[model samples]
Target chain A: MIDRLAVIGVGLIGGSLARALRAAGQVGEIIGCGRSQENLELALELGVIDRYAQDPAIAVRDADIVFLAVPMGAMRELLASIGPHLATNALVTDGGSVKNSIVADARVAFGCMPPWFVPGHPIAGTERSGVGASFPELFRQRRVILTPLPETDPKATARVRAMWQATGAEVSEMTVAHHDEVLAATSHLPHMLAFGLVDALTRMDCSDEIFRYAAGGFRDFTRIASSNPVMWRDICIANRDSLSAMLARFSTEMSDLAASIRDADGEHLLEVFARAKAARDGFVDGGKSLAEHN
Target chain B: MIDRLAVIGVGLIGGSLARALRAAGQVGEIIGCGRSQENLELALELGVIDRYAQDPAIAVRDADIVFLAVPMGAMRELLASIGPHLATNALVTDGGSVKNSIVADARVAFGCMPPWFVPGHPIAGTERSGVGASFPELFRQRRVILTPLPETDPKATARVRAMWQATGAEVSEMTVAHHDEVLAATSHLPHMLAFGLVDALTRMDCSDEIFRYAAGGFRDFTRIASSNPVMWRDICIANRDSLSAMLARFSTEMSDLAASIRDADGEHLLEVFARAKAARDGFVDGGKSLAEHN
Candidate 1:
């Protein structure tokens, strides 16, 4: 019945998943694993999991499911150490932002494509990270994109989809490569722009005064730039190719728009602004939650 | 004491100021004037003003204080109509976003700076507009930037500054040119970029699917893009030169950033990202209300 579950790297995503599973009564036992002893203690204290272990191998010893919630860069080392320890019937998944690299690692570590390895990315998070920000309803009304590899088993994919659906998330599937590309366009490139904008503003020496006067416009434009540097650093590295391509395309568009504005072409500027406004409305119309951000 | 105050264009900013003034017992009677009969009726219904007049000239006939809360484009026409009727000693102010253009309008309409005509920009707003969104605390803890022209009366400026302080806002003084430039860099250009980015995304054939998958970053980046189109359009035109300059600078930076990423220059990308992250932190450190967004 896939009752017992052990989530490695019990940070915000993993801990929150544990909490949701318990609240929904979807699993029998929840064991939390992380490199940080303090985080493990906090997860247990928060009642996100019933037990904990330090080693990834020890944590997944008898579990029916294991989630690699660690950073993408750390996934290879983790999968290598724990792959042989996982029961053949156990489902292995991850909450990593990038799926392709991790999918490759899993294949290499397990000596073949693991039928039960279903990679997923939950489109939900907050600027605050680690176990401190974990909550059961974090995924409520959120989208969870599943990018199962070609060799993934249909039954395993269904199980993973069902698990996320139980958390009140809508599940959809895409190929790993497509997921990386689409996300780079929609998510990663925006973060890069935000980070780049803020950096440019900071180096301008006018930041202190500029920030003081930052009203609604600046607040929203720069909000996502306040995310954890280490986490974002890893994301940028892991999804370099897609991010690079998206940034190039975005820069081209930005330059074109800039040229139109510089020429005082109000009609052109209005057309661009109108298009953006329509797109934003379409996003709201798509029934996505504006809550839960980073 | 400013017993009877006349609010021009009884919309969000004007109505909100009237409400706040009434709540603070700072005014004995609040009279609202607007071209729209329905707006006048709505303003009265919402208690945004104690009374309403169809003509601005009649509304300010006996008013001790007059606040122009119309769009920048409408400012000149409004001042030209109401200038001769303003009570001789009345203190006049405005809630316009762009100050440079308004200053010029005030100078031409009033003929040798009116004793009470003060240019002010309250750096506070919501995504919603109109009389319905007006609230008493809209200015609390918000910045109120005042741009006093070369010939502005010192007494008039002080009176205007005191009025803003009563609404619980911190006041700063700057030149009209500088005010427009600073705001263009911080507010206007950012909005334009948001609108442009969203527009670019929307114009793409894959907009529907892309929007459906938009997560935190895209949503935040595009939120300001969804702000009142009319108001933003006016802002872009009124502050075009400064906005153009800022846009050009930002585009250059974005281009450089894009090139850095495309070249797989991780070190350069990380540096840029780090600077942006720091500036955003500094903005938060400067106490911009990011939490209030959601």
Candidate 2:
């Protein structure tokens, strides 16, 4: 059991982790840390955390485990602030969507790859955020991917895996680069397309009529465009290389589709659309299994 | 109040219209016409129509009103087949997504815009199709747009509007060109983006991992990619001009976003994202009213 667990940035991910640990009797004390006093207080009142701290260093001073759940852009600053005060044996992991940058930042802050620093991401979340959105079951049956450095201690990695398992998550390990690339395609690129589509429609001369006549298909396709802007902006910049490559690839595909339409090439358009439908069908089948597990 | 109502190409839209008219007691007889024997049989068994016919011309022989609910690409063939057989006083309306194509096709087949020909589009549907998926409430509170030609009889247009109203739909009128332009932005462009995204990911080397790790956002954003390929292909070709214009505009926006990401212009990215979020929020708010009406 963790004697004390410190969670920096007590929002949806951190608060949910704290709640899950408490329910599983895996942590003796949970300390919430954040720049937002209101969020920390809300976490305390919700019983997701046992106490609160405004300073990251103070929060990690005596903690047996520390989880940094802040936005991707804030990871470097947060790691530097807590590096000096963290107990030498404390197991540290994160819930950031992007990992390469966090892993690199950890190297800079700690002077080397810290054995106890296990870079992790829980492949679970709603468009909603903040402390009030926290729930103990958020990670149940969800995939929590750990991208451990070569210098990481096996014991620390196993401990982090076990903690996530206690919350009913399936933990898997992969290289940091691989994790970033996979997420860039599946998550980040989709968000970019959604935001771009909505932004494009907003700038159209017939914007009002377009929105008024939009059917359920349009609504579902652009639903993700309503996600938190600042958080997504950070993600876009943090994973720029992978996301930029994906954008170019997607643009090429779109251009080909446009050409087919322009030329009235029904056969080519049907071929692309049929392939996409088949692929989407497979994805939906796979998603059902994932949904059942979660 | 209609003596007879014939619905050709009985599928989701046509079958639903027949069912809604029956529920409202707006027709003396309902004749379902389609090429698919199985679909017509299902519609007959479901009592969505009072009878079934394999020939469109024979089906509309003595009908007071005839609804052509076929894909945009099939509009020309269907119009040609039924034009010579249409009753001189029969009011003919269609549920085609693209109005300009249907209007032009009707004029070509009939030698002129028949005074009774009214092109209409119901801004409603689920991804699922076929007669089995039809329901009486499909068009309730939905918007049914009527695009009447200059030669259209005002009496016939009023009757068509009244029939849709009896089914609980809100009927509005717009020019054929305007309707196509609005739907090109609201519906066709979004579908193209969805199909393009899915097709792009399918061509990736890590396609399996991409689909496996995709979250709810990806699922929601690509749900429409699984829609009927032939129908969407037809739409892509029929509304090529407007949809192509929208596609270019969207590409420019996407390129601007990519440039922002490459330059690490976080402020610009945040501004674009914030605007999209606000627009989507307003859309969701407006959509709530539309949802309530439907």
Q: What TM-scores do the predictions have?
A: 0.92, 0.96
Q: What is the lDDT of residue A176 in candidate 1?
A: 91
lDDT of 1 at B187: 86
The digit string of per-residue lDDT tens for model 2 on B157-227 reads 99999999998988999999999999988899889988999999999988998888887788888998998
lDDT of 2: 0.90
Query: For residue B122, what is the lDDT in candidate 1?
Result: 92
lDDT of 1 by residue, A203-253 (tens): 666666777787866888888887777667778778878887776666677
Clashing pairs in 1: A198-B276, A199-B275, A199-B276, A275-B199, A276-B198, A276-B199
> Residue A85 in candidate 2 has what lDDT?
89
User: Candidate 2 - CAPRI tier?
Assistant: high
